[model samples]
Target: MTLGRSAGGVRLQDVADLAGVSMKTVSNVVHDYEHVSEAMRDKVQAAIDALGYRPNLTARRLATGKTGMIALAIPEIDQFYFAELGRHIGEEAARYGYRILVEQTLNDVEAERAVIRDRDEGLVDGVIFQPARIDTLEIARLRPGTPLVLLGEAARPVNTDHVMIDNTRAARDGVEMLLGRGRRRIAFLATVHGDITESTHLRLLGYQEALLAAGVGLDAHLVLQSEGFGFEDGVRAISSAIAAGVEFDAVLCRDDLFAMAALRGLEIAGRRVPEDVAVLGWDDTAVARYSTPALSSVSPDKQALASAAFALLEDRMQGYDGSGRHEIVAHSIIERATT
Candidate 1:
């Protein structure tokens, strides 16, 4: 006999009956038990699809004490980099039957603190955080009573898992590549220049290291600071340098957006690329390849970063009480017309 809870309501028993399995077996399949045989799982899944069964999340969480939801906090969702990161993380979480709640911190310290101090407990199983302006000391003091995975170089070696690329090394390699093209007077176009963040600091260190290694004198004038990380900022930085008679044969922009802008600015100034000045950028975003003159960039392993972050968060949720984990994904340079 088929058990019916109410009209148009499908219960667990319905699935079990459809799959010709016991209720316990249906529950095992629903909960993703590892020991379930492949054939059995397939049969149960087929039954579920036929019946369109969906477990009640509230009941599941109440019984399991897990919300099956994680929060992803980044600076902004509109920005291409963060948007791409969010999409990857959301897809990854979905693979494990979890959902990701995305939040924008706007790179503000107070906003980041608010996210850390979220009052709703168990609303999310954990957090994958990318802090922009919050200091490490402040982050160390927060009582975020949940699992956390740090997504970038900031807030490192904290009481959480960290996934990142070697910013310093990548930056150094970018400069070295420019140097190899016989470009000595390389300008560093950076965002957040005066109050440097961890990423900016590391990239600058790498730039200086490359210069010193190549026996090139570091010209203070060659380092241009910008208030923003955008095309206009790149244009302004390069244009201002030109107006000031600051001689430079190349530019190492902090990101692809800036590099594309620098290219336009250089073109407007009647400078030829490769022949007169070469440009390099980091992040190797999609737009880099299609820019007017394809931009050379530092391509970090973004897929690896997302995978590692999800793994760390899952381990934490599974009650792994080990010390903080730090994983650095690899990066490489993509050569193009600019350099």
Candidate 2:
């Protein structure tokens, strides 16, 4: 029997009939119920493909009281690390039959609070937040019972799930790589004025730790502070350091964008990469691989981070009432042409 594309097109019952299975079985397959056999799933999926069947998401949401949508809030989507991480998180969310609704918080406190507020309104099933400005206490106060997975180097709330790499250890390894190459005059870049963020504090601590271990005193002048964490911020910071007669044979940046900018700034200052100034970056973003002389970087396992964060969020969504579970994903240094 041929199914015609009419008023509502193909239905679930139509797909079941075509697959020679009960409607319940088709429903199970559509919902990705684990108890369904692979053979039955394949049969139902084949019929679904043949008829171009689409599940009624509105009806499902109404029946289950879940929107099957996840909210991902980040400081900036344009930043290389966050952008790459979002892509990975999106792919991981799809594996669980969910779509992502991204909210760019831009490190604004109000914007970050809005994401938690929206989740309370039942707009999305849960939230994956990477907060930059707000602290853990405020997040805990705002999200009393919402399913939240905190990302990045922010202090994790007491009872909220969190996922991140060990920033201090990763930074130490990156700097140690430079030290192993006989680079003593290393400049730690990407410091900001005022209250330091957790990420910057940890990375800088690691930088100092490595220098101290090598018996090299941390020079106050070699630590270049930036106005912000943007590409231009890096460029200006490095250029100003050069113009001000800062002497350094190596530079370790907080992120890939800064490292790439340092490359340009150094070139403008007539310093050859590796030969005159070795540069290292964090995040190991795609740009790191293609930058001039390539960027040696600290590579965090982004896929593992997404997987762990989603797993925690999924557990929370499924009524897991345990305390906050903090997961530390793996990271390593990628020594490229720059070092």
Best by TM-score: 2
lDDT by residue for model 2 (1-339), tens: 222222357887898889999988987887788999898899999999998887776666765788789999998898888999999999999998899999998778789778786666777888898988888898888764668899988758878889999998888898888999999999988797663468988999999999999899989999998988778888999999999999999999988988998998999999999999999998999999887687899999999999999999999999998889988999989989998
Pairs that collide, model 1: none
What is the clash count of model 1?
0
TM for every model, in the order presented, reads 0.93, 0.94
Off by over 4 Å in 2: 1-8, 194-196
lDDT of 1 at 119: 29
After best superposition, candidate 1 residue 135: deviation in angstroms? 1.9
Off by over 4 Å in 1: 1-8, 191-196
TM-score of 2: 0.94
